[model samples]
Target: MTAGPRRRGPARTVLVALPLAVFATVGVLAPILAPADPTANDLAASLLPPSAEHLLGTDQLGRDQLSRIIHGARISLAVTAAVLAISVTVGVVAGTTAGYAGGFVDRIVSRVIDMAVSLPGMLVALAVIGVRGPGVENLVIAMSLWAWAPYARIARARVTGLRASPHLDALRLLGAGPVRIICRHLLPPALAPCLVYASTDVGAIVLGVATLSFLGLGIPPPQAEWGQMLVEGRPHLASAWWLAYPPGLAITAVVFASNLLGERLAVGDERPSILRWVLPGRLRVRGGRALAARVTGVPATIATTSAGDGTLLRVRNLSVAYPRGSEHRRVVADVSYDVPRGKILAIVGESGSGKTTSALASFGLLDPSAVVTGSAMWEAGAAARQLVGLTPRERRQINGRRVGVVFQDSLAALNPLRSVGAHVDEAVRNAGNPGQRTAIRRVSEDLLHLAGLPDPATVTRQFPHQLSGGMRQRVQIAIAIAGEPELLVADEPTSALDVTVQARLLDLLARLRDELGMAMIIVSHDLAVVTRLADNVAVMYAGRIVESGPLDAVIGNPDHPYTRGLLDAVPRPGTVPGTRFRTMPGRTGAGPDDTTGCAFAPRCPDVVPECAHQQPRLLALTSLPAHRSACPRQQSDGPALAAETARDPDGV
Candidate 1:
């Protein structure tokens, strides 16, 4: 399951991290470590320059330069720490809130951040410091006040991007609240960059503080600070070179240390692989373990499970719409469905039929601009639950364990840079299982086999870009089924494959259902494909289910005219030459001002005057139980009149 080159503890990391850690620790103990009192004056040593008694000679005030520089370490570290703490805290909170709260809130927050950024930070800090006198607390406050706005802006931008990210959206649909979604899924990824920014800022901030103090507007006199010493020694540069050089060198060293540490930490984390041994054994082993966990199970969603129900997943009256210049255009309307433990209920539809939107809304996948006013329920297997109104963490509990998805596009789904095995392993850990190297590889191989891929070992080692389209789809299937999920929602899994490959994939799906008893929901425009695979069928048009029922009954005796038209349009081979095929009249389009009776009325062949005056309700026709049609004239039209109904297109 290992991917590419493994991450190792670089020589540079140790070189930087160790020294900075040592420096910071020593700075904390500076008051005790200095040989002479940092503030005490000696008249004899004053203006005497460097000597055995005074390693760095004395300042104009007769203070030992060496002692003062050592003591100054305490102030520098404190200011750096204070600025980091204040700015990071303020930035993370404000950025995430504004990012998640899109539209007017986002606009307003972004504008304020922009305004702050446009102003010169040093100038602002100077103004604030001018009002407040020179002191440790005042210096820290001044730097932080100017520094925090940038952090906030960065955090907000990340949150804005992550709020719409697939992972966060998945958590949201699982009933996660805004706070949990931001904190768990959104925050961790954002923190890596934030940390790097904070580290780099420390050097600039320390310099700023020093610059202020040197100007006599920083720490007060007699404080034994480096900046104050620099100011006092300026007049004696020709007579005494030792006093100024020592403190300047110390400042330069600390700044360099800060830069080095920040760069090492910036590397953050990388996926584990066989090559990771290039790193120290401990990190390599840990990474291997983590990769193993990912391949074996579902990735843990940042959702909670305390709100009980084995409800697993649910959606009720979920409607979504896009805003035009002045009006809202509906995309998903009054859609609802639920999946219990170990069952798959397919939502079938064509492009723009709202199949994807319905799926997304079930897990909160829409943009924040889209208005959502429905409850999605979630119940872990054998656990009672409410999917809607539950926090994002709660919903996350079911994402990998109970619900997994396989999209139509496989290549776009998996990461291009990662190997198939490592990709699978990532999911295993995300599900919170034990991550061991051997275990992950074994699980990854098993998943490949389960997906009906040949030569599991060879395939697992290959990157996504190296695989064929069908093979990529198999990998996607492996990922979706990695957690041994209770429900698998496959959106046109075989659509992209040729007929031969499609048949094989369908067989694999059927086997999974028979062997695992996992529930399935497959959306497709191919009725013949659905007829063979699905136990029940749903026909969707214009963002609504026009008809739905058991597969046989729906195909044999479709109650909806739309379904009949679709069946008439299916290509049948071996027909005579020059024969014209049946085609559904009118193109699919949604006008902003459209307020017609039925959405499909413009396209329906059996459109009557009444059909254009009122919307149809889903009602039972004189058909088998569980079969329903959303049409005004169903049972009223007898079977003898079926031939005249909609003219059956042109020819069979």
Candidate 2:
């Protein structure tokens, strides 16, 4: 899937990483690499400048500056290694544990991490050294104490963000325990950022140790150190320049290497020079990323236009594909549905079924690699817009401003740095409100309250992390409705919340529809999750809608095997005790066009021989004009399908 790349990753590994490697190697073999004893003093050669014997000249006491610098590399690198090891280990463990075990423990640990970060790191090291006295052990401990907080903070943020992810949800569904989920799944991604941060941290530790040694608290005298050499060379800075320059250059080289290497690794690209990449923003990057984009500006009036017909959004044969190798692979194929005014349409499917892709692709919200096609006539109004081919500029006028979205992951959607008020206020401004500061703040609080947050004033001041899952989702709703959008698209908004919270959010959505007369398209993996929120439901399988109709019609008389399986999986009110959830017996990761015949034929219990040979088109059922099913076995009254079925019986 990642075959097409415009640029190769940063080649700075040659420039920076190799130098850092050489630094480590020199540190490891300092004794062998150094020509003379760094500590051996020669009165006869004292104060001699650079020559054949002493390459970097001699310090005031005639200690070979090159040897001292080489040995000093050993001390600095060792201290950095020790401190990094200790800090990374403690930080990752503490942060992972706290992030994994949330609520009070997470709050407590987060506060502790914050305090640790707030402390003067150098001062903390100094205090630790003051108590324990100067030595390698004390220096390592002091530096480690100073260093651990940043790693902890990084890990905690990473883990916290991932805690409610679908991957983790899937793990839990598979009966994986907490330890397995955290260690096997969570640790790898969390560690990537920490390791990258550690690359930059190498410089900080080396500099810290050098600073302490320069102040006489680190590596205590006679043993040659870079900082000690600098101190000795201080008086002769003007007369003999070689004394300070070599060690100074050595320190600069190590620091520069670490910083550049970290920058290269973190960005995951070769050109950290001019290009910037982020997951979602003004400029977004994803798999086989499109580096930048140009304007496809929307006509000004389309943002305020309304559909006169009952349908708010009428999508026909909508297809979305991403480049896979040389060809485009369809993730969503010929998918069609509608969101009627003041009604909720639910798109339900298993993970990778492309429910989210179909909804997001309609709005230009998918990764830039996605190539979308077909007509999405975004309103039945006279001034209707075709959303499929719209530029980002045009999509923006409709999406965030006219049609709001509440993402499945509210934590990911909301900025961790920005408070609730800031997010809402920004949305309000972006929605074209452009109100005064006090007026905007007031509107933001009102919107938060409208989204079902009781204490809007208190909630406004809190960050995304400070709020619970339900609160965060509510905040997302507030931000979404800042534009008073006619349409709302919520992608599994309540999936991460508890039953009570989920119920409350659903109620809020229903209430919003009744009050604002807004249409909504809600996407979900579990059919049961959105049953309460949706008026009409479309059950998607392998990127195709298997069945779609009114909530009761599809739920009660599910014609497609996949739809039946989804209905079976939902726990019933009068179910027998200890009954296991009935899951379909196949993976849900195939494309609609991957199989020539029925995509679900292999997994379908009712699969006939003909089902393996031909794909079935979604046709109107004999029972109802609005209801439709893709399974040929589900009798349809459509003339073309009926005649084809009667003539061939197998659609061969």
Task: For candidate 1, give the lDDT of residue 187.
Answer: 58
lDDT of 1 by residue, 1-652 (tens): 3433333455455566564565577678887877788888777667777789877778766787777877787777777888889988887777778888898988987888888788887888788888987788888888887788888888887767656555454445445577776765565545556777776687777778788889887888788667777888889899989778877877777677778766656664421321243222221234343221223332233112222224456666666777777978888776655554444455666678887777766644456556655666554445556544444566566666666788776766665545788777766666655646667677678778778887889987788889988888888888877766766888788877899988888888887776666767787778767866877676777776667666777888987878888888777788788788787787666531244666777788887776676665554444454566767566345463344333421101
Q: CA lDDT, every prediction?
A: 0.69, 0.78
**How well does each candidate superpose onto the true structure, as a TM-score?**
0.63, 0.54
Candidate 2: the clashing residue pairs are 10-269, 10-270
**What would the TM-score be for candidate 2 when compared with the true structure?**
0.54
Error of 2 at 634 (Å): 2.9
Count of steric clashes across candidates, in order: 49, 2
lDDT of 1: 0.69
On TM-score, the candidate that comes out on top is 1
